[model samples]
Target: MDTKPIAYTMSEKENPAITVHVVKKSVTPNVPSGNDSSNVTPTTPVAPTPSTPTGETIKQPAKPTIPNYAAKKGAAVYATRALYLYKNENFKNSQRLVKYPKAKRVNRPMFVVTDYARSTNGVLHYKVRDVNHGSKTAGKVGYITADSKFVVPVYYQSMPKNKKIIIINKKGVNAYKDANLTKRVKNYKKGTRLTVKKIVKHNLASRYQLSNGDYMTANKKLIVQGDYQIINY
Candidate 1:
């Protein structure tokens, strides 16, 4: 049972604000007794003035936004033998560099790395051979810098053509016919053993060629690359 009127006013200023106010008015008539009619004075009621109506506020246009390319210039995870260049960095008066695409389910790109160096700004730079697009820079060594946040320096190891052993440290690893792990040939459970016939590495990860001719990922997370002995289950 509410009978109060709700009122609101909008400011006409450039940056207008909305305000709301609620008001209630009540008046009661005073009745005098017949014996005190002469002594009682009639009081006059004050009239209320009309309030001016307010107009709606118009919204102002939003300010234009500028992108910060510096913050977007970040480091990419790279391997000693391969790395993907940042799409944001371009050669002198050249086009933006291509990003090294990764294999399916793999986290890193597939560029073959040839050399790496640190710039004066503490950025890590890698020289790699390009593929796919076959741009003018293809087959030639092109330098790409990596942000420090994602750079991991690695030492190059020269191993003989002899067989090498690596241990699987993770669960549910996939073995494929190719280095890209596209056509899965088998799924290896944790504790499975693998004898590496040949170790091939690209920018994103390394692939191990088994004696049986099947290949599996040799990512740092999937296998330990040291002298850890394999135990027969």
Candidate 2:
């Protein structure tokens, strides 16, 4: 019996050198004429053949796509107060702007400026990267009129040290996952004094970026801000 490997090749119209191995079955050795049939050893079964390939073969996985809003590390910035974000430098019209988060009524939008340019009219336009916000437009980058009245360029003067804050709000206030008051992290009882590291303002509310880097809200009217010094500019 023959004992050679069977080769599978494409038709003449297809690849000529490309060959694949299918079955490699070995022929049973011829039994001696005097040997009994019961003494013959059983042959191993052949593996099933592979299915014919149809679609274009893929060798590697597709690369993960980078999102348009992917955060790029740059000069750190902070918003002096809440402000509006526009699609272009011409914000006076309001028609040329992207929709801001209206349902949450977040008037004071805050973010870090990523890029800046001057319009023909000598207006300064800044590409601000929105920090976490309560609206669907959160984490977006857009141009805004940086007239100093709104956006203020700030730097890290020093690492914030621990400071004590008292919750004067008789009702209570909420802790948040982000500086924006969109997500509630926890709730604090009235008179609940907390030792927070830093104080900041984002979207109309004063937020505490804690020593552990967690954030919580301090409503302007509810929590007293005069006592706690704003350290991080």
- Name the candidate that leads on lDDT: 2
Task: Kindly give the stretch of ten consecutive residues in candidate 1 with the minimal lDDT sum.
Answer: 66-75
Candidate 2 residues lying further than 4 Å off, grouped into runs, are 1-84, 90-95, 99-107, 132-134, 152-191, 195-224, 228-233
Please give each candidate's TM-score. Answer: 0.33, 0.34
State each candidate's clash count: 4, 1
Q: Name the best candidate (by TM-score).
A: 2
Please write out the lDDT profile of model 2 over residues 1-233, one tens digit for every residue: 45576897666765566787766576778766646767777789999998867996868975544333322234333444445666666665563445433222123344566766556676666777776557666787777655555444332222234365555555667777777766776777666667677777563334677556677654333344334543221
The C-alpha stretches of model 1 lying farther than 4 A from their native spots are 1-162, 201-204, 227-233
RMSD of each candidate relative to the true structure: 26.4, 23.0
> 165-218, model 1: which lDDT tens digit per residue?
454544557888887778888887765656677777654356677889988766
lDDT of each: 0.51, 0.56
Name the lDDT value of residue 157 in candidate 2. 24
